[model samples]
Target: MKLFFILFFLLVLSVVPAYSYLDPGAGSMLAQLIMGGVAGLVVLFKLYWGKFKSLFVKTDSTTPEKDNSSQTE
Candidate 1:
């Protein structure tokens, strides 16, 4: 992780400028990529975090829920 940060920082600090022209579509794509990755990680964290917490904490949700189980018209 430390090495990855160092490499990223070096790349960000490079004196050479990029000569390539990035169109708006490419910029939007990059934005979506970053946002999608972050969203995916958040979802994964929520899923695993729930399981992790369940290891030590007990919830009543494990029992059969009856909110919509009975319908009498």
Candidate 2:
């Protein structure tokens, strides 16, 4: 672990910046990718909203209660 950290520090300290140009098209593509991923997640959440909501919600009994008030003596 120590040797790994030493090597990582040396690499980071010796790293040189590459003169790169980020074109507008590449930036727009990256933005679209981020937005699409977010929109996809939103749609998935909307589709399974009921199931996701049920995870934290409590349910009452499914059986109906008997009404004794209508019983004859």
Candidate 3:
């Protein structure tokens, strides 16, 4: 499974062209890097989102009862 994934990734990367003439200015490079980083982060978060949400989710059966008692006697 791991080998297959690596091979698939390498195949995809091979198809992508290296930095071309269009990315000439610093601004363009920065923009591309930012967009790429954001896209990668989204993919990463999506992959782990289920586990991340489950981290905060309650799974226990017992629910704490609400306290309605007033401080004033």
Per-residue C-alpha lDDT of model 2 across residues 10-62, encoded as one tens digit per residue: 45764545432333365466445435675644553453575567679876523
Model 1: CA > 4 A from native: 1-35, 62-73
Candidate 1 lDDT score relative to the true structure: 0.52
Q: What order do candidates take by lDDT, descending?
A: 1, 2, 3
Best by TM-score: 1
Among all windows of 10 consecutive residues in model 2, the one with the lowest summed lDDT is 64-73
lDDT of 3 by residue, 1-73 (tens): 6545644664574464444323247446544543566564455445357556867996652332223222211
> How close is every model to the real structure, measured as TM-score?
0.35, 0.23, 0.22
Worst 10 residues of 1 by lDDT: 64-73
Mark the regions of model 3 whose C-alpha exceeds 4 Å error after superposition.
Answer: 1-36, 54-73
On a 0 to 100 scale, what is the lDDT of residue 37 in model 2? Answer: 72
Task: Supply every candidate's count of residue pairs whose N, Cα or C atoms clash at under 3 angstroms.
Answer: 0, 0, 0
- What overall lDDT goes with each candidate model? 0.52, 0.48, 0.47
Report each candidate's C-alpha RMSD, comma-separated, in the order given: 17.8, 24.6, 18.8
Error of 1 at 51 (Å): 0.9
Looking at model 2, the pairs that clash are: none
Ranking by TM-score: 1, 2, 3
